[model samples]
Target: MPLTPQRAHLQFGVVLLAGALLPALPLAGQQVLSVFAAASLTEAFNDLGRAFERAHPGVTVRLNYSGSQVLATQLEQGARADVLATADQRWMQYARDRRLLAGDAATFARNRLVVVIPRANPGYVEKLQDLTRPGLKLVLAGAQVPAGGYSRESLRRLNGAPGFPAAFDRQVLANLVSEEENVRAVVAKVRLREADAGIAYATDVGARDRDALTILEIPDPYNPIAEYPIAVVAGGHRELAGAFIALVLGPEGQALLATRGFLPPAPRR
Candidate 1:
């Protein structure tokens, strides 16, 4: 007896339905990991989150990116975040000093401090020494911001350097344009030519949609290595948070950081 074509089609359809239904049971129970990171990590972490979603189907990622100081303040004020990645260890230390972070954190990336100038270069602030030129507009991050702290230190070093103090007084200190609230704001002002130049992270400058700014690298003799650390915030989603941290420390995450103009995490000294 020849089985009818409709019966054959119905049998195949039933088999397909069962196979599709079998995978749906586990898809509905996936987890979500939330991370609070610095603004500079906007690009890299967003990419990491997407990659993570692809690797772990059904799991979702929620990211809050802002200034490191602001994020730290949020954590202290009881924000719920599984992972907290800071721009520098100082902020993380503050979180730990207050018992905000649960355990030891790992350094996940390093960034270089670079001076950004407007494409217009109206004041002709072209070199590191020119940053201190008198009457040339300049912008810097506020004292609490990581880039500000680094810039202040760099200026001190320049002032102390033999034959450099004169240059610092003439270019950097004299120009004295404005002090910004954060690194991102500093970059933005310079990109808009509101100020002649500004100090910021290389990664920050690289993130700008328009490449209208010129970067002046701090000479090696006075350059400070900037590093970022990741820690788990206490009382947040610790397990999944740790998973996110592990992902940042993993090969895939490191690769993304490198692609975004950051130096890979170095071996502990």
Candidate 2:
């Protein structure tokens, strides 16, 4: 029998109907990896996220930045995330203790604490010891924050130094006007002149705020190094999470972190 136009049109219609009846599938390689990271990593991680997306087509990187402790609590409460990056080893250890991590956390970067004052020099704060000046308003991170813990440790080490008073730490604590939730908030308080001075990570004063703040480097002896650790969450996208970690530990990520003032991870034994 010879093929006819009417029969051919009917066959095409049936094919279209069958295609429409099938389940719709996602595009190949399309995936989303949600990352819960420390607030201090905001800038660097954002840049890294973009870079990772560019390198891996059809993949999206979602970032949630907050205090390390805050993020840990969220994970403990069952928030869905593929990876967790913390500003300190303690929080990563906290996650490990709760069985939230798939493997051992890897240290990715390190940072140091610094004293920042408003560009106007409102308190005549030229040295670290100046934080104890009478009536000076000092801002710091909340005691639970990694940056805050480092700040307190640094202040305690500064106390009783050659020129500092015996009760220097006590006096500085007395002058605290605000305890912010994160290091960036402390930077903002000082940058906007809301407080006379604040303690923050050295990287907190980036190029944008360099003109708005004065950064005073803390001596090594009195400074505490903040170590960053990253791990894949137990029930999230494990393969993608590993890939993201590789990018972060690779040269490009390391270079980007260094450019943002973060120190390279300490040598592994």
Candidate 3:
């Protein structure tokens, strides 16, 4: 029987509807989860993502790494993502205040600032005080970034140390040759010898870059502990985000973070 025009139009509409629904079909068996994370977590999170995929077949983790402040701004501007992991609690609070989070946030890890220098040590910067040397070039994360805020705070503590002069912090700030948007960028500058030295999270210098850079540990009194937070983003895959967060806080994830130089979260009493 020949198809009438009206019937043909109805058949085409059904086909279009079916096509639209095909992506959501269970047979497709693929789900993509978007994660926005701080730049310092790049390597460790990538490892964790792979572990997650292995445990949950047919799921893929897509990551966007940037400064915590930048990520909060993106979420506020309506960027779609399943999870947000930041280097500090302040930005997580920013998301919560705006009602962008699906549930309470979890503090997963901690980090500390260290001075990174090229393996060659061109500027001969051996200690924190050496950053004040004349003509030395130093790079740091922008003041708005969590790592930057911590870096400045550490310098202030150094200035107040009994042996250090009052102008210590001011002199170190004078050698600033560049201010990057993220801690990873500061590590990159030091690794590439673009700057004599840069302050970065201890975890930012991964195994791959360790050979190219030298880490100068900051004294306990002068170093500020950086707390990392994770939460599910509102209007996203809440279940999946929660699962990922669990994986991060689980034994395997904590072990991985420790191996990568990140400190484990303080035990709850």
lDDT of 1 by residue, 123-183 (tens): 7976677666667788888778887888877776676586576446345755667777678
lDDT of candidates 1 onward, in order: 0.82, 0.92, 0.92
Model 3 whole-model lDDT (C-alpha atoms): 0.92
Winner on lDDT between 1 and 3 is: 3
List where candidate 1 sits over 4 angstroms from the true fold. Answer: 1-30, 166-171, 207-210
Candidate 3, poorest ten consecutive residues by summed lDDT: 23-32
Model 1: ten consecutive residues of lowest lDDT: 165-174
Could you tell me how far off, in angstroms, the CA of residue 231 lies in candidate 1 after the best superposition?
0.6
lDDT of 3 at 169: 80
Candidate 3 per-residue C-alpha lDDT over 1-269 given as tens digits, one digit per residue, 9 for 90 to 100: 68999999999999999999986776465898899999999989999999888988989898999999999999999999999999988899999999999999989999988999999999998877788998999999999999999999999989858768788889999999889999988988888898999999988887788789999999898899999999999999989989999999999999988888899987898
Output candidate 1 Cα RMSD.
10.1
Q: How well does each candidate superpose onto the true structure, as a TM-score?
A: 0.83, 0.88, 0.88
Backbone clash pairs for candidate 2 read: none
Q: How many steric overlaps are in each model, in order?
A: 6, 0, 0
Positional deviation of 191 in candidate 3, in angstroms? Answer: 1.1
What is the lDDT for 98 in model 3? 99
